[model samples]
Target: METNSMEAIVLEAPGPPEALQLRELPIPVPAPGQVLIRVKAFGLNRSELHTRLGLAEGVTFPRVPGIEATGVVAAAPAGEFAPGQQVMAMMGGMGRTFDGGYAQYTCVPAGQVIPFRSDLDWAVLGAVPETLQTAYGSLTEALDVRPGQTLLIRGGTSSVGMTAAVLAKRLGITVLATTRNEAKAAALKGIGVDHVLIDDGAVAERVREIFPDGVDNALELVGVPTLPDTLRAVRKHGVVCFSGMLSNEWIVKDFYPIGYLPRGVRLAAYGGDANDLPQAVLQEFLDAVAAGEAVVPLDRTYRLDQIAQAHADMEANRAAGKLVVLP
Candidate 1:
């Protein structure tokens, strides 16, 4: 545990889970307008998995591959934040153009950091940053969801889907969540879903069976494979926010908006960073989580040394919720 050097899971080149190797690297020093974060914990994302498999574009190796982190501010060269202030950082070229949260330290632009205070454990806190920002942004910015609206989460068991369910319920929206696994249905129910639809590729008819006029909105987390059916599951003027890509099939070849979208069923996509998560919203969510009014869908936690196994479990779809690593 030297002050200058820290442990990190470095991706030497795109390959398997074993490619994420633990190594000692110099703690990054922040320049003006940048903040140095003493990474406590970081969350595993499919984005990182895609990078490891060389599916992601613009990735450079030997790199650290974590997109989101939660920790305390070790230094803010621009004085944007006080030392020891708790914060979360994500995106802004993290784990992509430069070293990211896969290390014990990561330096990111100040604009990419959102400040918050909570007594929640680092593991729980780590899971909230990117996941919550994406979920909350998709709900508010992409879908414009409101109270009394009915939401259909196409990938309910995924972390973002589950988090969206919680946020939707808290907003007084009626929730209908879908899961491919019958065993995971109860997990969705535990989060206050009004109905749990078993997804067998097409859940539109089944959605109509419940809502009749179709749901007021839908959150498509399974990517383009389910986008069409999800579009059909929404009512006229209802929106579908394309968010997560649990299936890792994001691109839709020969996409024709006219034929692709159901008339009046508008489709929107959300790919947000930390800046999209307003400070107030982040603080409120953290407060809710700390008060037990909300929950972080954290499935399991691992140490820095277990990054390979963690990535393997993530790739294998073994976790029902977010997988986090403590560095």
Candidate 2:
């Protein structure tokens, strides 16, 4: 690959994972207030998979598909970022609007980039920015999780769910996580979760056994299908944060009004708007990673050429943690 031309995974059409193909394209230049990164690794999210399959609209074709990435700064606006500095960035309209981290290099706005601590590995750092921020935002800002409270995290073993579980534990909040896999129950316990429910229809019953009435907060990662169930598991005056919908159901049947509103519940959705969350929360998430209170698990790594396989693995739910694409 020439310096001015780099290899990237491009989706010329929407369909299966095989739609992704590696091709050489002209390297993009960073604009003012932007930095060019020599991407070391990028993490895959369900949003990327949706975008690749045309499930997520508004994304132009021939797009490079990756949202969260960690890399070395190749170039930056003067006084903004120094060359060779390690950094991470995440958000939409990134891999969505312009080319993203599926390539050898990507140019992101300097404002969106965060410097990583020297001790962090590139793969771990790459995995941190998106899921951690989402979890932190939902827990602290949306749900106002506090010490002595109890939180129920649906999709407990997932990257965001696990991040929420660890952060909540650190804050003195008891964590009860839900998983479809019984094998993951032990892993949840190892990560400081107090309880792990194996997706039984009796989630409310199990929650009552642990928290008596219900949990103080809930993080709904599975979306609509679990929304009603989450409502049933939260205590009066509790809060619920909705962020993901991996269940593939777009239309939520009927709202469980009595279960949510009559109980003085707060239902919140985040990640659509960046400014909806404070930058301080994002910094706190990064600091937690720096201090070793939180860790981003790198389940597998694939080369840029293996993007199709990576997507396939993610869609199959075979990845236990973050999946990284090394360029």
Per-candidate TM-scores read 0.98, 0.91
**Best model number under lDDT:** 1
Model 1 misplaced regions, further than 4 Å: none
Tens digit of per-residue lDDT, candidate 2, span 1-327: 436898888888788998888999888888888889888888888888889778886788778877767888999976598899887766747778877788888888877777755566677766766777788778867888889999999888777888788788889998999988787677788788898899875577789877788888999888887787787788888888887776755556665666445367678776643444355665666677778776665678888888889899888777656788888
* Superposition TM-score, candidate 2 onto the true structure: 0.91
Top model number, TM-score: 1
Q: What is the lDDT for 85 in model 2?
A: 87
C-alpha RMSD of each candidate structure in angstroms: 1.1, 2.4
For residues 1-327, could you state the per-residue lDDT of candidate 1 as single tens digits?
A: 447998888999999998889998888888999999999999999999999999999998889998889999999988999999999999989999989999999999998999998899999999998889889999999999989999999989888988999999999999999888899888888888899999999899999998899999999999989999999999999999999898999999999999999999999999998889999998998899888898889999999999999999989887877999998
Among residues 3 or more apart in sequence or in different chains, the pairs in candidate 2 whose N, CA or C atoms overlap within 3 Å are none
